[model samples]
Target: MNKNLRQTDQPLRQILTKPEVSSRMTKWAVELAEHDIGYRSRTAIKAQALADFLVEGASLAMTGQDSPPSGERSGEPWILFVDGASSKEGSGAGLLLISPTGEELTYALRFDFPASNTEAGLADSPPDGYNRGQSQERSQLVVLQVRGEYEAKEDVMKKYLAKVREVIALFDIFEIERVSISQNKRADALSKLASSSFAHLSKEVLVEVVKQKSIDQVQVLAIDSSATWMTSLMNFLNSGVLPGDKTEAYRLQFRAAKYAYAGGTLYRRSYLSPWLKCMTPEEGDYVLREVHEGLCAAHVGSRVLAKKCLLLGYYWPSVFQDAAALVQKCRACQVHAPLCHQPARKMVPIHSPWPFAQWGIDLLDPFPRAPGRYEYLEVAIDYFTKWMEAEPLATISGRQFRISSGET
Candidate 1:
């Protein structure tokens, strides 16, 4: 259809088709290079019947679709196909909405930032546009986490899932199923088009470039600073105030003996050591991250890591457990750690094939300076035969031992 639309008049074609033409015509000819076509004059109609046939055939050949229906339209639900693509060129997604009348509308969407493949048709409300033409009782959503079927791993997508859930809650009936690539060609083509570096297209395809995640609008959260774990202890230490409950006050008094406030920081008294600065879980997490993988840190084991923090004058109740959890979650530690090998069953012993089949050599020193100026004795033993031979040497050297029991 694009070729048919770009088909030009005789004079214009002559200019564009010429071997030597203007720069503009040369560019047009290059764009139309794949289309090797020439115009032919339409013959004069012989009769009314023949003329009607030619006109109708020409119209059908030009547009390849019948004129819109005059009355009621098709009532089939418009099926939608979606696919995602990611490459070095860019990350993108595409949607292909097929009308009940077999008309296809393809969308090419480009993402501005790097992330796992997202629903190309998701951010765009493709269903809302077809409200006038399709069923309205319920909407089916098929997520084409396609290509890799990527899970929503990124925080942006995780947050986006909440919004998607809220919208999906309104649907009465919905169904989703994995579809083969053959059935999703249109959307896949559009996805590739958006993700590739092809700057020129035969037909003008307007790509919707999403500059940022739609769900990333800033949100303000109110956090209570005075309600933390140490808040009560700090209040009691700063001022002589206690909670209204006698049991709670008694417990606070018992725990407070071990905690000392100094330099505007809470410290816990350590046995045979200086006071350890007590840390909240949040601060403890930062301490753990830095100390575990920080400069000069060798990614030590959990027990050692916790001990290091304790030795550094920091205290947290879950320090040991947190260190263990951090080590488990550490990507480098998991990927590059040494492998463990354990025997599947009890050990077994084996006997040698024959006497002197294998030989062992050993060195012994100092025999009061032998005739060859050798101080060490090199001994050979046969595993099966218990045969032994010895030679004296003074200096260590790298050479094959000549066994007295077997072929050298």
Candidate 2:
């Protein structure tokens, strides 16, 4: 009856010859069409329905869902995620809040400091005046983006767990029934007014935060594509045993290349892909190209690659031989030679039975004893006891005469 159905008449004729096959196909088409219509609508409704059914089916499922009574519970814990930026001109900090109801609240500060997340394009100049949406905002922007981008990555599960731990620390603050986060101090202040601490609330009454469902998977595809795996592999190689071969080296090179292609250049002159900026490489071609070029540049049948391989390090910058040689021959390093410290002085304590244990002896010569007499004085003291003896001599070298006088 339908034009689309008419096109399938040849297959249907064959099926018609076998009444059983025709019956099955007709039933299958009806069921498939019905399923298609139902499936589209069910995507949203079905998940909620399933959740409700599961919650109803088991009382234990609702255990983690309990919210304390508002009167008994402290005001909701407020979280402020701050993003900051810094430049030669100044610095800025930005904040964001996630409410219990999945609302996003944002705030920004422009000022100066040694705040977190200062690195950006690595250029010497700031682009323009401060604006809320400007990327030129600097450190705050970079850190926030980094945090968000990092959270979007697959390897951020441990970090995400850490954030959860941080949020849990609020239990020390108040009887937290609900948790909210703000980018603005105003929201934080408001929440603080509601409940400054959650310590008064029972552990059972404190509601476990319902994390944003999309956060776990946020910008995931972009994150995976842009992620440079070389550093991770390099870390593994440094901390553990890495298999030796062209394959391993090639893998490392690939990661470097991808990073370079992704604007992770030592010179900071590389192109930035908007797609890559979002979170990941839109196409894997850049990564492949980067890897190939990196391997060629690093390996090129030289000992530089070998020297690099022998080193075990974390986050060591990728330095070619020229850079290594420059660092080695640095004037400051040559002039400031490595320290060679003198041995520590050994403590030698002075000991005596009464006072001084020993005394020193000396001679004073060429002294005028009288108007016409040239003379010397023989002086002695007990080394430890400090007892002194002195004798006036008519001439130098009168040791024999002094001894005869019983100076001892």
Candidate 3:
């Protein structure tokens, strides 16, 4: 019995030592051995079997899966999952491609603009071909699975969808399916990760994303010879010659003395102040909006708005006027302004010829009951002298008025 068992163990050891099987199974066995010492050998055997199954699947994809005849059915399908997310910070798209052999490749993109889901989908289409390269030509079937409705409703979305369809038309076979968000969690997570503040990607990964330029900066940098104001300033500064009237020429000369151009930017200089950034009309508007109503702005009044722009070292000919106009048009200020309490009309005084010539009398009623059952009082005053007389009464009537007036 012992000899028979040894013979069987020898055959098993020889089978495990075979080069073709050992090369593939060695790494799997070594990894499984780290955690489960008691069952390491068994686990290694199981892992090796699983790896063989995967290899078989891949081999089948390469050999048996041939493209169908022209105008007939297509080859095995490649699976694609897509998702998009938008946040206050930015927008992002995620795509996962599963090859015929079940190998998965993930891709993520971050957008500077607040992109809609449809836009993200449109943005994702071109990258698929770029990543697949020549393989896309051989791929006969391509199925795209998204987490929401595939229909394009908005005009912008329709344009994006049309582009996506154009991209899809390049492939011989294409299909689109709408799946639940939960089913597409991996792609969804990738999108959220791209949109998140903490997703710090390497420069190589972010090379394709375009950085956003500030409206003020873009308008300022867009200044060229075609811009009349900028051209006049540039010519005046460069040659000391003015193009218009003498008064305008003198004004330009004076301004040219105060202003200078460096690296394509116009700057104003003064002995007492720091260099002020001179801006065009559009740039001025952007500065006013950012200064008066940006994230840290307090919605200051017109004069203060202009002062704020000046303090921030920005200058334009119509800075004050533009600030005033922007403040006047501000809906927040209009909706939240405080009520006014000042009198609208002027007051005139009444004069009396004598002390008692013009007397004003009034009756006070419903006072707390005092001594002698008095509940009402009649008061009289002389307008000129500002003198007063008062008498209390238990009852108020015509007879009481006559007694109070000393007419009885």
Give each model's whole-structure lDDT.
Answer: 0.69, 0.39, 0.68
Better of 2 and 3 by lDDT: 3
Per-model TM values vs. the true structure: 0.31, 0.18, 0.37
Better of 1 and 3 by TM-score: 3
RMSD (CA, Å), each prediction: 27.4, 28.7, 23.9
Tens-place lDDT digits, model 2, residues 1-408: 222223332354455444566566766565444332211111235788889888786776565467554422544444434333444544344444444344665543333222223321111112122111111122333334333443423333344434443443434442112122332344333222213232332343322222232123355354434445344443443454354787976766555443322344221122542222211122222322232234543222223432332231111233344334443454554565557586688778755556445545577877767644637777777756678778666666556455724655
The candidate scoring highest on lDDT is 1
Candidate with maximal TM-score: 3
Question: CA lDDT of 52 in candidate 3?
Answer: 97
lDDT tens readout by residue for model 1, 160-247 = 6666555544544333445677777767777778888646533656687788776775778998755667778888898867899999
Candidate 3 wrong stretches, greater than 4 Å = 1-228, 343-408
lDDT by residue (165-185, candidate 3, tens digit) is 667667665656556667688
Q: Which has the better lDDT: candidate 1, or candidate 2?
A: 1
Model 2 poorest ten-residue lDDT run: 120-129
